[model samples]
Target: MKANRKLVAAAVGTAIAPVLVLLSPAGIASAHGYVNAPASRQAQCAQGTVSCGQIKYEPQSVEGPKGLHSCDGGNAQFAELNDNNKGWKATPVGSSVAFTWKFTARHRTSNYEYWIGNDKIATVDGGGQQPPETVTHNVDLKGHTGRQTVLAVWNIADTANAFYACIDLQVS
Candidate 1:
């Protein structure tokens, strides 16, 4: 069957290149997608620790073919995230990229563990003063170029289930 008109147009839009962000969060690291997090486990920007991720993606689109499409097609997927880390993804644009994030302790994520691609990204997990903080990083995504979606998941170190997670993807 022929593709829907809107979907075709959207696909063209993605191929042509428009600001495309998956708004998702990673892989090979036991990172679960953010949508999986329980609503009660939701982390407040002002109460939890913040980890940021920078991402880049192959040609995709915010406006792309809808309905069952291929991986190569622009997808509205919530980047997978887990308690292992927190971050944001962005496509290499004109010059630089920016990131801002926070994690709250109020979610009872006792002993929260955080990392950024193998680096310790945070100090406190779920205990202590529930610090509210922010960090900024800039990177050139001219390489590793593909759909870059940062992942952030929250779960007790010894626990199997995650409590909170989030991802912010910037596609261009």
Candidate 2:
């Protein structure tokens, strides 16, 4: 009888092991962040300023492998962000723009990069620490004028992944 009970206990543990792993943080895509101020593409979708599909619901989930240049983070659900003619509202700003980020799930970060075309405008080191709920970086947009798209990347320190946000701007 004791042997049968032990066998049942082992079976239950085996059955629930996969579920437990799924419930673990490491088992899920944990890092979530997005640029908020100046209204990034995902931000516009989340705020109803633009029409989008799945990305509209989880704007902060545009995460993929690091060193990617795509605005959607290579996520098919956020492919609308890659559409240049989607009528994404361009925020008007001066040469210096402060880009704010909102993090849903904070992770140790490596750095934040801002790019305009092939030019890297700014790179703020994260110092391998978890950031606050909201972080802002003032990026100089000098030498850039008129309509432009800024790609912002948040590279995670501990993971080989990064969060992406693309901000459209009408710079002065």
Candidate 3:
């Protein structure tokens, strides 16, 4: 009877192990990367400039499938990032501003692209090499001005997905 009980306990543990791993923070941490400077929506939450849920813990992990442009990275847990009414502070930036990215797990990059209000503003070709801990690009705002949201994308060189970071800016 004791042997049967032990066997059942082991079976239960084995059955739940995969579920536990999938729900672990390490699994989420693998998502990687976010805009650090200029404070992307997730960054603000992570820094306590804004109150958020799970994203506040792993701000660098607000990732989603590529080709979609959304501030929350399509992760509903980070949907707070999509909330415009949260009073997300917009950083004042010049026409040519330097944007920085913080990566927890750096992957090979195909390119970096930036968009402001439906217009593609800048694209930096990142020759299929892993970036440093932090990467910065000087984006030319050109004719854009006033308040705007900058959507930055880091396209993975080997994967079909990309990480997205959206920053609210007061461009001058």
Q: How accurate is candidate 3 locally (lDDT)?
A: 0.88
List the lowest-lDDT window of 10 residues for candidate 1. 54-63
Clash number for each model: 27, 0, 0
Error of 1 at 11 (Å): 61
TM-score of 2: 0.84
Candidate 2's C-alpha runs over 4 A off are 1-31
lDDT digits (tens) for residues 1-172 of candidate 2: 9999999999999999999998997845654899999899999999999888988888999999998899999988788899999999999999889999999899999999999988999999999999999999999996899999999999999988999999999999
Quote the RMSD, in angstroms, for model 3.
3.3
Q: What's each prediction's TM-score?
A: 0.25, 0.84, 0.84
Query: How would you encode candidate 3's per-residue C-alpha lDDT over 1-172 as one tens digit per residue?
Result: 9999999999999999999999998886575799999899889988999888898888887777887778887888888887889899999988888999999888899999898867899999989999999999999998888998999999889888888889999988
How well does model 2 score by local distance difference test?
A: 0.93
Better of 1 and 2 by TM-score: 2
Instruction: Show where candidate 3 strays beyond 4 Å.
Output: 1-29
| True lDDT of residue 116, candidate 1 | 31
Best-to-worst lDDT order: 2, 3, 1
Candidate 1, superposed: residue stretches over 4 Å from native: 1-99, 102-129, 133-143, 156-161, 164-172
Better of 1 and 3 by TM-score: 3
As a TM-score, model 1 comes out at: 0.25
